[model samples]
Target: MTAKPPISALTDHLGYWLRLVSNHVSASFARRLEAEGVAVAEWVVLRVLYDVDALAPSKLAARMGMTRGAISKLADKLVAKGLVDRADDLEDGRAHTLELTKAGRALVPRLAKLADANDRAFFAGLTAKEREGLKRLMERTAAQLGLDDIPVS
Candidate 1:
Protein backbone atom coordinates (compact mmCIF):
# COMPACT_ATOMS: atom_id res chain seq x y z
CA MET A 1 0.00 0.00 0.00
CA THR A 2 1.15 3.56 -0.76
CA ALA A 3 1.79 5.84 2.17
CA LYS A 4 -0.38 8.97 2.45
CA PRO A 5 1.19 12.39 2.31
CA PRO A 6 1.57 14.28 5.58
CA ILE A 7 -0.97 16.99 6.29
CA SER A 8 0.16 20.61 6.07
CA ALA A 9 0.75 22.75 9.14
CA LEU A 10 -1.90 25.30 10.17
CA THR A 11 0.34 28.16 9.03
CA ASP A 12 0.87 26.62 5.62
CA HIS A 13 -2.29 28.09 4.16
CA LEU A 14 -2.85 31.79 3.32
CA GLY A 15 -6.37 31.54 4.66
CA TYR A 16 -5.04 30.43 8.01
CA TRP A 17 -2.89 33.53 8.29
CA LEU A 18 -5.70 35.76 7.14
CA ARG A 19 -8.08 34.21 9.65
CA LEU A 20 -5.62 34.65 12.48
CA VAL A 21 -5.32 38.35 11.76
CA SER A 22 -9.04 38.70 11.14
CA ASN A 23 -9.96 37.02 14.42
CA HIS A 24 -7.74 39.33 16.41
CA VAL A 25 -8.97 42.44 14.59
CA SER A 26 -12.60 41.45 14.94
CA ALA A 27 -12.31 40.50 18.59
CA SER A 28 -10.64 43.78 19.44
CA PHE A 29 -13.31 45.74 17.59
CA ALA A 30 -16.02 43.70 19.28
CA ARG A 31 -14.61 44.58 22.68
CA ARG A 32 -14.48 48.24 21.75
CA LEU A 33 -18.09 48.14 20.61
CA GLU A 34 -19.14 46.35 23.80
CA ALA A 35 -17.65 49.14 25.88
CA GLU A 36 -19.97 51.49 23.99
CA GLY A 37 -22.91 49.17 24.75
CA VAL A 38 -23.16 48.00 21.15
CA ALA A 39 -22.59 44.78 19.26
CA VAL A 40 -20.60 44.47 16.08
CA ALA A 41 -23.75 43.75 14.11
CA GLU A 42 -25.46 46.75 15.63
CA TRP A 43 -22.48 48.93 14.74
CA VAL A 44 -22.68 47.81 11.11
CA VAL A 45 -26.37 48.71 11.01
CA LEU A 46 -25.87 52.04 12.70
CA ARG A 47 -22.97 52.97 10.45
CA VAL A 48 -25.10 52.31 7.42
CA LEU A 49 -28.00 54.27 8.85
CA TYR A 50 -25.83 57.20 9.91
CA ASP A 51 -25.96 59.12 6.62
CA VAL A 52 -29.46 58.26 5.53
CA ASP A 53 -32.67 60.00 6.47
CA ALA A 54 -34.57 56.73 6.40
CA LEU A 55 -34.25 53.45 4.57
CA ALA A 56 -36.54 50.50 4.12
CA PRO A 57 -35.70 47.33 6.00
CA SER A 58 -35.76 45.30 2.80
CA LYS A 59 -33.35 47.68 1.09
CA LEU A 60 -31.05 47.64 4.10
CA ALA A 61 -31.09 43.83 4.14
CA ALA A 62 -30.16 43.75 0.47
CA ARG A 63 -27.42 46.32 0.85
CA MET A 64 -25.96 44.55 3.86
CA GLY A 65 -26.28 41.15 2.13
CA MET A 66 -28.34 39.86 5.04
CA THR A 67 -31.71 38.16 5.24
CA ARG A 68 -34.74 40.28 6.06
CA GLY A 69 -35.24 38.31 9.26
CA ALA A 70 -31.68 39.08 10.36
CA ILE A 71 -32.10 42.75 9.58
CA SER A 72 -35.36 42.77 11.50
CA LYS A 73 -33.72 41.21 14.54
CA LEU A 74 -30.94 43.79 14.54
CA ALA A 75 -33.40 46.58 14.08
CA ASP A 76 -35.48 45.31 16.95
CA LYS A 77 -32.48 45.46 19.25
CA LEU A 78 -31.60 48.99 18.15
CA VAL A 79 -35.21 50.07 18.57
CA ALA A 80 -35.29 48.63 22.06
CA LYS A 81 -32.19 50.61 22.90
CA GLY A 82 -33.85 53.79 21.60
CA LEU A 83 -31.15 54.13 18.98
CA VAL A 84 -33.35 53.58 15.96
CA ASP A 85 -36.94 54.34 15.07
CA ARG A 86 -39.24 52.27 12.89
CA ALA A 87 -42.05 54.03 11.14
CA ASP A 88 -44.52 52.91 8.51
CA ASP A 89 -43.38 53.69 4.98
CA LEU A 90 -45.39 56.53 3.55
CA GLU A 91 -45.92 54.88 0.20
CA ASP A 92 -46.19 51.35 1.51
CA GLY A 93 -48.19 50.98 4.67
CA ARG A 94 -47.17 47.36 5.06
CA ALA A 95 -43.47 48.15 4.99
CA HIS A 96 -41.43 50.06 7.52
CA THR A 97 -38.54 52.51 7.21
CA LEU A 98 -35.72 52.80 9.71
CA GLU A 99 -33.95 55.94 10.84
CA LEU A 100 -31.49 56.73 13.55
CA THR A 101 -32.74 58.55 16.60
CA LYS A 102 -31.02 61.74 17.73
CA ALA A 103 -29.14 59.69 20.28
CA GLY A 104 -28.08 57.22 17.65
CA ARG A 105 -26.83 60.01 15.43
CA ALA A 106 -24.83 61.39 18.30
CA LEU A 107 -23.28 58.04 19.07
CA VAL A 108 -22.19 57.19 15.51
CA PRO A 109 -19.24 59.56 15.40
CA ARG A 110 -18.00 58.35 18.76
CA LEU A 111 -18.24 54.77 17.58
CA ALA A 112 -16.42 55.70 14.38
CA LYS A 113 -13.60 57.14 16.45
CA LEU A 114 -13.42 53.90 18.40
CA ALA A 115 -13.27 51.91 15.14
CA ASP A 116 -10.39 54.10 13.94
CA ALA A 117 -8.57 53.66 17.21
CA ASN A 118 -9.05 49.91 17.21
CA ASP A 119 -7.65 49.66 13.71
CA ARG A 120 -4.64 51.79 14.61
CA ALA A 121 -3.99 49.76 17.72
CA PHE A 122 -3.87 46.46 15.85
CA PHE A 123 -2.17 47.65 12.68
CA ALA A 124 0.28 50.17 14.10
CA GLY A 125 3.18 47.83 13.57
CA LEU A 126 2.82 48.36 9.81
CA THR A 127 4.07 51.55 8.22
CA ALA A 128 1.52 53.86 6.61
CA LYS A 129 2.43 52.65 3.14
CA GLU A 130 2.26 49.04 4.23
CA ARG A 131 -1.15 49.61 5.77
CA GLU A 132 -2.46 51.27 2.63
CA GLY A 133 -1.06 48.46 0.50
CA LEU A 134 -2.68 45.86 2.73
CA LYS A 135 -6.02 47.64 2.55
CA ARG A 136 -5.78 47.92 -1.24
CA LEU A 137 -4.90 44.28 -1.58
CA MET A 138 -7.80 43.21 0.60
CA GLU A 139 -10.20 45.40 -1.32
CA ARG A 140 -8.95 44.00 -4.61
CA THR A 141 -9.36 40.47 -3.33
CA ALA A 142 -12.91 41.16 -2.21
CA ALA A 143 -13.74 42.71 -5.55
CA GLN A 144 -12.27 39.75 -7.35
CA LEU A 145 -14.39 37.43 -5.24
CA GLY A 146 -17.51 39.54 -5.88
CA LEU A 147 -17.88 40.01 -2.14
CA ASP A 148 -20.05 43.04 -1.41
CA ASP A 149 -21.42 42.09 1.95
CA ILE A 150 -21.02 44.41 4.89
CA PRO A 151 -19.31 42.14 7.41
CA VAL A 152 -21.36 42.30 10.60
CA SER A 153 -19.69 39.74 12.78
Candidate 2:
Protein backbone atom coordinates (compact mmCIF):
# COMPACT_ATOMS: atom_id res chain seq x y z
CA MET A 1 0.00 0.00 0.00
CA THR A 2 1.20 3.54 -0.83
CA ALA A 3 1.56 6.06 2.01
CA LYS A 4 -0.61 9.18 1.82
CA PRO A 5 0.76 12.71 2.35
CA PRO A 6 -0.48 14.74 5.26
CA ILE A 7 -2.83 17.64 4.51
CA SER A 8 -1.98 21.12 5.67
CA ALA A 9 -4.32 23.46 7.51
CA LEU A 10 -5.35 26.80 5.92
CA THR A 11 -3.45 28.67 8.65
CA ASP A 12 -0.22 27.00 7.60
CA HIS A 13 0.10 29.35 4.60
CA LEU A 14 1.43 32.95 4.68
CA GLY A 15 -1.07 33.95 2.01
CA TYR A 16 -3.91 32.94 4.29
CA TRP A 17 -2.73 35.33 7.00
CA LEU A 18 -2.05 38.05 4.47
CA ARG A 19 -5.47 37.63 2.91
CA LEU A 20 -7.19 37.74 6.28
CA VAL A 21 -5.67 41.14 7.07
CA SER A 22 -5.97 42.41 3.51
CA ASN A 23 -9.65 41.59 3.24
CA HIS A 24 -10.49 43.40 6.44
CA VAL A 25 -8.35 46.43 5.61
CA SER A 26 -9.74 46.66 2.10
CA ALA A 27 -13.32 46.23 3.17
CA SER A 28 -13.02 48.91 5.82
CA PHE A 29 -11.52 51.32 3.31
CA ALA A 30 -14.25 50.55 0.81
CA ARG A 31 -16.92 51.22 3.38
CA ARG A 32 -15.27 54.51 4.32
CA LEU A 33 -15.26 55.51 0.64
CA GLU A 34 -18.93 54.65 0.27
CA ALA A 35 -19.90 57.59 2.47
CA GLU A 36 -18.08 59.82 -0.02
CA GLY A 37 -19.83 58.15 -2.96
CA VAL A 38 -16.77 56.52 -4.50
CA ALA A 39 -15.85 52.91 -5.16
CA VAL A 40 -12.37 51.53 -4.46
CA ALA A 41 -11.54 51.45 -8.18
CA GLU A 42 -12.83 54.98 -8.69
CA TRP A 43 -10.80 56.20 -5.72
CA VAL A 44 -7.68 54.66 -7.26
CA VAL A 45 -8.24 56.50 -10.55
CA LEU A 46 -8.98 59.76 -8.81
CA ARG A 47 -5.86 59.44 -6.67
CA VAL A 48 -3.71 58.79 -9.75
CA LEU A 49 -5.09 61.79 -11.62
CA TYR A 50 -4.51 63.99 -8.60
CA ASP A 51 -0.74 63.87 -9.11
CA VAL A 52 -0.95 65.09 -12.72
CA ASP A 53 -2.96 67.79 -14.45
CA ALA A 54 -4.03 65.31 -17.11
CA LEU A 55 -3.04 62.08 -18.85
CA ALA A 56 -3.91 60.20 -22.01
CA PRO A 57 -6.23 57.29 -21.32
CA SER A 58 -3.75 54.88 -22.90
CA LYS A 59 -0.95 56.23 -20.74
CA LEU A 60 -3.15 55.94 -17.69
CA ALA A 61 -3.95 52.33 -18.58
CA ALA A 62 -0.26 51.50 -18.90
CA ARG A 63 0.54 53.11 -15.56
CA MET A 64 -2.37 51.37 -13.87
CA GLY A 65 -1.73 47.97 -15.47
CA MET A 66 -5.34 47.81 -16.53
CA THR A 67 -6.89 47.37 -19.95
CA ARG A 68 -7.90 50.46 -21.93
CA GLY A 69 -11.46 49.17 -21.97
CA ALA A 70 -11.45 48.96 -18.18
CA ILE A 71 -10.03 52.46 -17.93
CA SER A 72 -12.64 53.77 -20.36
CA LYS A 73 -15.43 52.31 -18.27
CA LEU A 74 -14.03 53.82 -15.08
CA ALA A 75 -13.46 57.13 -16.84
CA ASP A 76 -17.03 57.11 -18.05
CA LYS A 77 -18.24 56.61 -14.50
CA LEU A 78 -16.01 59.41 -13.21
CA VAL A 79 -17.26 61.72 -15.95
CA ALA A 80 -20.84 60.90 -15.10
CA LYS A 81 -20.09 61.54 -11.43
CA GLY A 82 -18.64 64.95 -12.44
CA LEU A 83 -15.32 63.99 -10.84
CA VAL A 84 -13.35 63.82 -14.08
CA ASP A 85 -13.30 65.52 -17.45
CA ARG A 86 -12.51 64.03 -20.83
CA ALA A 87 -11.31 66.63 -23.25
CA ASP A 88 -9.97 66.60 -26.81
CA ASP A 89 -6.20 66.55 -26.80
CA LEU A 90 -5.09 70.00 -27.84
CA GLU A 91 -2.18 68.70 -29.92
CA ASP A 92 -3.95 65.65 -31.29
CA GLY A 93 -7.53 66.17 -32.31
CA ARG A 94 -8.07 62.45 -32.64
CA ALA A 95 -6.99 61.68 -29.10
CA HIS A 96 -8.49 62.58 -25.73
CA THR A 97 -7.06 63.21 -22.29
CA LEU A 98 -8.39 62.57 -18.81
CA GLU A 99 -8.18 65.12 -16.02
CA LEU A 100 -9.74 65.50 -12.66
CA THR A 101 -12.44 68.12 -12.28
CA LYS A 102 -12.26 70.80 -9.60
CA ALA A 103 -14.46 68.64 -7.43
CA GLY A 104 -12.11 65.71 -7.81
CA ARG A 105 -9.08 67.80 -6.91
CA ALA A 106 -10.83 68.90 -3.75
CA LEU A 107 -11.90 65.41 -2.84
CA VAL A 108 -8.53 63.67 -3.26
CA PRO A 109 -7.10 64.89 0.03
CA ARG A 110 -10.22 63.87 1.94
CA LEU A 111 -10.12 60.42 0.41
CA ALA A 112 -6.43 60.13 1.17
CA LYS A 113 -7.15 60.89 4.81
CA LEU A 114 -9.63 58.05 4.89
CA ALA A 115 -7.07 55.70 3.38
CA ASP A 116 -4.53 56.70 5.99
CA ALA A 117 -6.97 56.16 8.81
CA ASN A 118 -7.99 52.77 7.50
CA ASP A 119 -4.34 51.72 7.32
CA ARG A 120 -3.66 52.87 10.85
CA ALA A 121 -6.72 51.14 12.20
CA PHE A 122 -5.62 47.84 10.76
CA PHE A 123 -1.90 48.12 11.46
CA ALA A 124 -1.97 49.88 14.81
CA GLY A 125 -0.77 46.82 16.63
CA LEU A 126 2.56 46.90 14.81
CA THR A 127 5.31 49.13 16.09
CA ALA A 128 6.73 51.73 13.69
CA LYS A 129 9.82 49.65 13.01
CA GLU A 130 7.78 46.51 12.63
CA ARG A 131 5.45 48.26 10.21
CA GLU A 132 8.40 49.43 8.14
CA GLY A 133 9.86 45.95 8.12
CA LEU A 134 6.56 44.44 7.12
CA LYS A 135 6.24 46.95 4.30
CA ARG A 136 9.72 46.12 3.06
CA LEU A 137 8.95 42.42 3.08
CA MET A 138 5.70 42.92 1.17
CA GLU A 139 7.42 45.12 -1.41
CA ARG A 140 10.20 42.61 -1.83
CA THR A 141 7.75 39.78 -2.28
CA ALA A 142 5.81 41.76 -4.85
CA ALA A 143 9.01 42.53 -6.76
CA GLN A 144 9.97 38.87 -6.70
CA LEU A 145 6.61 38.07 -8.23
CA GLY A 146 7.07 40.74 -10.95
CA LEU A 147 4.03 42.64 -9.75
CA ASP A 148 3.83 46.28 -10.69
CA ASP A 149 0.12 46.76 -10.81
CA ILE A 150 -1.42 49.34 -8.52
CA PRO A 151 -3.84 47.31 -6.42
CA VAL A 152 -7.32 48.84 -6.49
CA SER A 153 -9.40 45.97 -5.21
Candidate 3:
Protein backbone atom coordinates (compact mmCIF):
# COMPACT_ATOMS: atom_id res chain seq x y z
CA MET A 1 0.00 0.00 0.00
CA THR A 2 1.15 3.57 -0.72
CA ALA A 3 1.98 5.81 2.25
CA LYS A 4 -0.94 8.06 3.29
CA PRO A 5 -0.64 11.82 3.05
CA PRO A 6 -0.38 13.71 6.36
CA ILE A 7 -3.60 15.32 7.67
CA SER A 8 -4.18 17.90 10.37
CA ALA A 9 -5.34 16.71 13.77
CA LEU A 10 -8.59 17.98 15.37
CA THR A 11 -6.55 20.18 17.70
CA ASP A 12 -5.02 21.88 14.65
CA HIS A 13 -8.41 23.44 13.85
CA LEU A 14 -9.37 26.73 15.57
CA GLY A 15 -13.01 25.73 15.35
CA TYR A 16 -12.36 22.65 17.44
CA TRP A 17 -10.83 24.71 20.23
CA LEU A 18 -13.60 27.27 20.05
CA ARG A 19 -16.22 24.57 20.17
CA LEU A 20 -14.55 22.98 23.17
CA VAL A 21 -14.71 26.18 25.18
CA SER A 22 -18.12 27.20 23.89
CA ASN A 23 -19.73 23.89 24.68
CA HIS A 24 -18.40 23.80 28.20
CA VAL A 25 -19.44 27.39 28.92
CA SER A 26 -22.86 26.95 27.36
CA ALA A 27 -23.62 23.64 29.06
CA SER A 28 -22.56 24.92 32.45
CA PHE A 29 -24.72 28.01 32.15
CA ALA A 30 -27.60 25.90 30.91
CA ARG A 31 -27.37 23.63 33.93
CA ARG A 32 -27.38 26.58 36.30
CA LEU A 33 -30.38 28.07 34.54
CA GLU A 34 -32.14 24.71 34.63
CA ALA A 35 -31.72 24.51 38.38
CA GLU A 36 -33.53 27.84 38.56
CA GLY A 37 -36.38 26.43 36.46
CA VAL A 38 -35.50 28.30 33.29
CA ALA A 39 -34.27 27.24 29.89
CA VAL A 40 -31.61 29.31 28.18
CA ALA A 41 -34.06 30.49 25.52
CA GLU A 42 -36.68 31.32 28.14
CA TRP A 43 -34.10 33.27 30.11
CA VAL A 44 -33.32 35.26 26.97
CA VAL A 45 -36.99 36.14 26.54
CA LEU A 46 -37.31 37.13 30.15
CA ARG A 47 -34.24 39.34 29.97
CA VAL A 48 -35.47 41.04 26.78
CA LEU A 49 -38.92 41.66 28.22
CA TYR A 50 -37.35 43.05 31.37
CA ASP A 51 -35.83 45.81 29.29
CA VAL A 52 -38.88 46.69 27.16
CA ASP A 53 -41.67 46.02 29.67
CA ALA A 54 -44.04 44.92 26.94
CA LEU A 55 -44.09 44.36 23.19
CA ALA A 56 -46.28 42.98 20.47
CA PRO A 57 -45.57 39.31 19.78
CA SER A 58 -44.68 40.09 16.18
CA LYS A 59 -42.33 42.83 17.25
CA LEU A 60 -40.68 40.52 19.75
CA ALA A 61 -40.35 37.86 17.07
CA ALA A 62 -38.58 40.33 14.81
CA ARG A 63 -36.34 41.62 17.58
CA MET A 64 -35.27 38.11 18.55
CA GLY A 65 -34.72 36.97 14.94
CA MET A 66 -37.10 34.12 15.66
CA THR A 67 -40.22 33.05 13.84
CA ARG A 68 -43.62 34.06 15.20
CA GLY A 69 -44.42 30.43 15.90
CA ALA A 70 -41.26 30.00 17.97
CA ILE A 71 -41.98 33.12 19.99
CA SER A 72 -45.57 31.99 20.51
CA LYS A 73 -44.38 28.63 21.72
CA LEU A 74 -41.96 30.19 24.16
CA ALA A 75 -44.61 32.65 25.30
CA ASP A 76 -47.04 29.82 25.91
CA LYS A 77 -44.48 28.06 28.09
CA LEU A 78 -43.70 31.26 29.97
CA VAL A 79 -47.40 31.98 30.46
CA ALA A 80 -47.88 28.53 31.90
CA LYS A 81 -44.90 29.09 34.18
CA GLY A 82 -46.48 32.29 35.53
CA LEU A 83 -43.47 34.25 34.38
CA VAL A 84 -45.11 36.24 31.60
CA ASP A 85 -48.40 37.87 30.80
CA ARG A 86 -50.06 37.74 27.38
CA ALA A 87 -52.82 40.25 26.81
CA ASP A 88 -54.93 41.06 23.77
CA ASP A 89 -55.13 44.66 22.68
CA LEU A 90 -58.11 46.57 24.01
CA GLU A 91 -58.74 48.18 20.62
CA ASP A 92 -57.64 45.31 18.37
CA GLY A 93 -58.90 41.91 19.35
CA ARG A 94 -56.51 40.14 17.04
CA ALA A 95 -53.40 41.83 18.36
CA HIS A 96 -51.69 40.79 21.56
CA THR A 97 -48.66 41.83 23.60
CA LEU A 98 -46.33 40.07 26.01
CA GLU A 99 -44.64 41.24 29.17
CA LEU A 100 -42.92 39.75 32.15
CA THR A 101 -45.00 39.00 35.18
CA LYS A 102 -43.94 40.41 38.55
CA ALA A 103 -42.21 37.16 39.38
CA GLY A 104 -40.25 37.24 36.14
CA ARG A 105 -39.07 40.77 36.81
CA ALA A 106 -37.93 39.70 40.25
CA LEU A 107 -36.19 36.63 38.89
CA VAL A 108 -34.17 38.46 36.23
CA PRO A 109 -31.52 39.93 38.52
CA ARG A 110 -31.06 36.57 40.23
CA LEU A 111 -30.70 34.87 36.88
CA ALA A 112 -28.28 37.57 35.81
CA LYS A 113 -26.16 36.83 38.84
CA LEU A 114 -26.15 33.18 37.97
CA ALA A 115 -25.08 34.04 34.43
CA ASP A 116 -22.24 36.21 35.64
CA ALA A 117 -21.03 33.53 37.99
CA ASN A 118 -21.16 30.93 35.26
CA ASP A 119 -19.13 33.14 32.96
CA ARG A 120 -16.56 33.80 35.62
CA ALA A 121 -16.23 30.15 36.45
CA PHE A 122 -15.65 29.11 32.85
CA PHE A 123 -13.20 31.92 32.14
CA ALA A 124 -11.31 31.71 35.41
CA GLY A 125 -8.12 30.74 33.65
CA LEU A 126 -7.98 34.01 31.72
CA THR A 127 -6.88 37.36 33.02
CA ALA A 128 -9.29 40.29 32.80
CA LYS A 129 -7.43 41.79 29.83
CA GLU A 130 -7.25 38.44 28.11
CA ARG A 131 -10.96 37.90 28.57
CA GLU A 132 -11.70 41.32 27.11
CA GLY A 133 -9.44 40.63 24.15
CA LEU A 134 -11.14 37.28 23.56
CA LYS A 135 -14.55 38.92 23.77
CA ARG A 136 -13.60 41.62 21.29
CA LEU A 137 -12.21 39.07 18.88
CA MET A 138 -15.35 36.93 19.10
CA GLU A 139 -17.59 39.96 18.68
CA ARG A 140 -15.63 41.11 15.64
CA THR A 141 -15.86 37.64 14.14
CA ALA A 142 -19.59 37.46 14.71
CA ALA A 143 -20.07 40.93 13.25
CA GLN A 144 -18.08 39.95 10.21
CA LEU A 145 -20.38 36.95 9.81
CA GLY A 146 -23.50 39.19 10.09
CA LEU A 147 -24.55 37.37 13.21
CA ASP A 148 -26.59 39.83 15.28
CA ASP A 149 -29.16 37.62 16.86
CA ILE A 150 -28.67 37.01 20.57
CA PRO A 151 -27.45 33.51 21.43
CA VAL A 152 -30.53 31.99 23.01
CA SER A 153 -29.50 28.37 22.89
Candidate 4:
Protein backbone atom coordinates (compact mmCIF):
# COMPACT_ATOMS: atom_id res chain seq x y z
CA MET A 1 0.00 0.00 0.00
CA THR A 2 1.14 3.53 -0.59
CA ALA A 3 2.14 5.61 2.41
CA LYS A 4 -0.28 8.34 3.46
CA PRO A 5 0.77 11.93 2.93
CA PRO A 6 1.65 14.14 5.90
CA ILE A 7 -0.79 16.82 7.09
CA SER A 8 1.52 19.52 5.71
CA ALA A 9 1.07 18.01 2.25
CA LEU A 10 -2.71 18.73 2.26
CA THR A 11 -2.07 21.95 0.36
CA ASP A 12 -1.95 19.83 -2.77
CA HIS A 13 -4.91 17.58 -1.86
CA LEU A 14 -8.17 17.94 -3.75
CA GLY A 15 -10.11 16.84 -0.67
CA TYR A 16 -8.51 19.67 1.26
CA TRP A 17 -9.59 22.19 -1.32
CA LEU A 18 -13.13 20.78 -1.37
CA ARG A 19 -13.40 20.88 2.41
CA LEU A 20 -12.01 24.41 2.64
CA VAL A 21 -14.45 25.73 0.07
CA SER A 22 -17.34 23.82 1.66
CA ASN A 23 -16.53 25.24 5.08
CA HIS A 24 -16.42 28.80 3.83
CA VAL A 25 -19.65 28.45 1.89
CA SER A 26 -21.49 26.75 4.73
CA ALA A 27 -20.21 29.25 7.29
CA SER A 28 -21.20 32.22 5.19
CA PHE A 29 -24.68 30.84 4.61
CA ALA A 30 -25.07 30.02 8.28
CA ARG A 31 -24.22 33.59 9.22
CA ARG A 32 -26.78 34.92 6.77
CA LEU A 33 -29.47 32.62 8.18
CA GLU A 34 -28.71 33.73 11.73
CA ALA A 35 -30.21 37.16 11.17
CA GLU A 36 -33.46 35.38 10.24
CA GLY A 37 -33.40 33.37 13.51
CA VAL A 38 -32.65 30.03 11.83
CA ALA A 39 -29.86 27.49 11.89
CA VAL A 40 -28.39 25.88 8.82
CA ALA A 41 -29.94 22.48 9.44
CA GLU A 42 -33.24 24.07 10.36
CA TRP A 43 -33.26 26.00 7.11
CA VAL A 44 -32.54 22.80 5.24
CA VAL A 45 -35.50 21.11 6.87
CA LEU A 46 -37.75 24.05 6.17
CA ARG A 47 -36.70 24.16 2.56
CA VAL A 48 -37.40 20.47 2.13
CA LEU A 49 -40.88 20.78 3.51
CA TYR A 50 -41.58 23.92 1.52
CA ASP A 51 -42.01 21.99 -1.69
CA VAL A 52 -43.86 19.00 -0.30
CA ASP A 53 -47.14 19.06 1.55
CA ALA A 54 -46.46 16.19 3.91
CA LEU A 55 -43.74 13.62 4.37
CA ALA A 56 -42.96 10.96 6.93
CA PRO A 57 -40.25 11.76 9.44
CA SER A 58 -38.41 8.63 8.34
CA LYS A 59 -38.44 9.82 4.76
CA LEU A 60 -37.02 13.15 5.85
CA ALA A 61 -34.35 11.45 7.90
CA ALA A 62 -33.29 9.36 4.93
CA ARG A 63 -33.34 12.30 2.55
CA MET A 64 -31.29 14.45 4.92
CA GLY A 65 -28.84 11.62 5.65
CA MET A 66 -29.67 12.06 9.34
CA THR A 67 -30.97 9.81 12.04
CA ARG A 68 -34.62 9.41 12.96
CA GLY A 69 -33.88 10.77 16.45
CA ALA A 70 -32.30 13.85 14.94
CA ILE A 71 -35.31 14.41 12.71
CA SER A 72 -37.61 14.01 15.73
CA LYS A 73 -35.64 16.57 17.70
CA LEU A 74 -35.62 19.06 14.88
CA ALA A 75 -39.31 18.45 14.32
CA ASP A 76 -39.96 19.27 17.94
CA LYS A 77 -38.06 22.52 17.68
CA LEU A 78 -39.86 23.42 14.48
CA VAL A 79 -43.19 22.65 16.08
CA ALA A 80 -42.29 24.78 19.08
CA LYS A 81 -41.41 27.65 16.75
CA GLY A 82 -44.75 27.28 14.93
CA LEU A 83 -42.84 26.53 11.77
CA VAL A 84 -44.09 22.96 11.28
CA ASP A 85 -46.81 20.62 12.35
CA ARG A 86 -46.48 16.97 13.24
CA ALA A 87 -49.63 14.93 13.09
CA ASP A 88 -50.82 11.37 12.87
CA ASP A 89 -51.05 10.06 9.35
CA LEU A 90 -54.66 10.13 8.17
CA GLU A 91 -54.38 6.78 6.43
CA ASP A 92 -52.43 5.23 9.25
CA GLY A 93 -52.95 6.99 12.53
CA ARG A 94 -50.02 5.13 14.02
CA ALA A 95 -47.62 6.84 11.66
CA HIS A 96 -46.72 10.54 11.65
CA THR A 97 -45.95 13.06 8.95
CA LEU A 98 -44.62 16.61 8.87
CA GLU A 99 -46.00 19.69 7.17
CA LEU A 100 -44.82 23.27 7.15
CA THR A 101 -46.88 25.95 8.86
CA LYS A 102 -48.06 29.10 7.12
CA ALA A 103 -45.13 31.03 8.52
CA GLY A 104 -42.70 28.41 7.31
CA ARG A 105 -44.30 28.37 3.92
CA ALA A 106 -44.02 32.15 3.71
CA LEU A 107 -40.35 32.10 4.66
CA VAL A 108 -39.42 29.61 1.92
CA PRO A 109 -39.26 32.10 -0.92
CA ARG A 110 -37.39 34.66 1.17
CA LEU A 111 -34.84 32.03 2.22
CA ALA A 112 -34.42 30.93 -1.40
CA LYS A 113 -33.76 34.50 -2.45
CA LEU A 114 -31.23 34.85 0.32
CA ALA A 115 -29.48 31.72 -0.97
CA ASP A 116 -29.47 33.09 -4.52
CA ALA A 117 -28.02 36.41 -3.43
CA ASN A 118 -25.40 34.64 -1.37
CA ASP A 119 -24.32 32.65 -4.41
CA ARG A 120 -24.16 35.77 -6.52
CA ALA A 121 -22.08 37.53 -3.90
CA PHE A 122 -19.66 34.65 -3.65
CA PHE A 123 -19.35 33.92 -7.37
CA ALA A 124 -20.16 37.22 -9.05
CA GLY A 125 -17.02 37.09 -11.18
CA LEU A 126 -18.11 33.81 -12.81
CA THR A 127 -20.34 33.99 -15.84
CA ALA A 128 -23.71 32.17 -15.90
CA LYS A 129 -22.20 29.54 -18.19
CA GLU A 130 -19.40 28.96 -15.75
CA ARG A 131 -21.89 28.53 -12.92
CA GLU A 132 -23.91 26.06 -14.94
CA GLY A 133 -20.81 24.14 -15.91
CA LEU A 134 -19.73 23.96 -12.29
CA LYS A 135 -23.12 22.62 -11.31
CA ARG A 136 -23.08 20.06 -14.10
CA LEU A 137 -19.64 18.84 -13.24
CA MET A 138 -20.47 18.66 -9.55
CA GLU A 139 -23.58 16.64 -10.30
CA ARG A 140 -21.63 14.30 -12.51
CA THR A 141 -19.01 13.81 -9.85
CA ALA A 142 -21.66 13.19 -7.24
CA ALA A 143 -23.29 10.55 -9.41
CA GLN A 144 -20.00 8.87 -10.10
CA LEU A 145 -19.42 8.79 -6.38
CA GLY A 146 -22.78 6.99 -5.88
CA LEU A 147 -24.52 10.04 -4.49
CA ASP A 148 -27.08 10.49 -7.25
CA ASP A 149 -29.80 9.32 -4.88
CA ILE A 150 -29.11 12.08 -2.39
CA PRO A 151 -31.75 14.76 -2.14
CA VAL A 152 -30.72 18.23 -3.27
CA SER A 153 -32.49 19.84 -0.33
TM-score of candidate 2 versus the correct structure, residues matched by position: 0.92
Could you tell which candidate, 2 or 4, scores higher by lDDT?
2
List candidate 2 segments past 4 Å from native. 1-5
Q: What's the candidate order when arranged by decreasing lDDT?
A: 2, 1, 3, 4
Q: Best by TM-score, which number? A: 1
lDDT of 3 by residue, 32-92 (tens): 9999999998999999999999888898778778899999999999999999999888888
What is the Å distance of residue 149 in model 1 from its true position?
A: 0.7
What TM-score would candidate 4 get against the native? Answer: 0.88
Runs off by more than 4 Å, candidate 4: 1-8, 148-153
Clash pairs (backbone) in predicted model 4: none
Candidate 3 segments whose C-alpha is farther than 4 A from its true place: 90-93
lDDT of each: 0.93, 0.94, 0.92, 0.84
Q: Give a tens-digit lDDT track for model 4, residues 1-153.
A: 999876667678888987897777778888888888887788888988888888899998898888889889989988998999998988986789999999989987898888888888877888999989988998899978888434422
The order by descending TM-score is 1, 2, 3, 4
TM-scores of all candidate predictions against the true structure: 0.94, 0.92, 0.91, 0.88
> Model 2 Cα displacement at 91 (Å)?
2.6
As a whole number from 0 to 100, the lDDT of residue 25 in candidate 4 is 76
Pull out the clashing pairs in model 1.
Answer: none
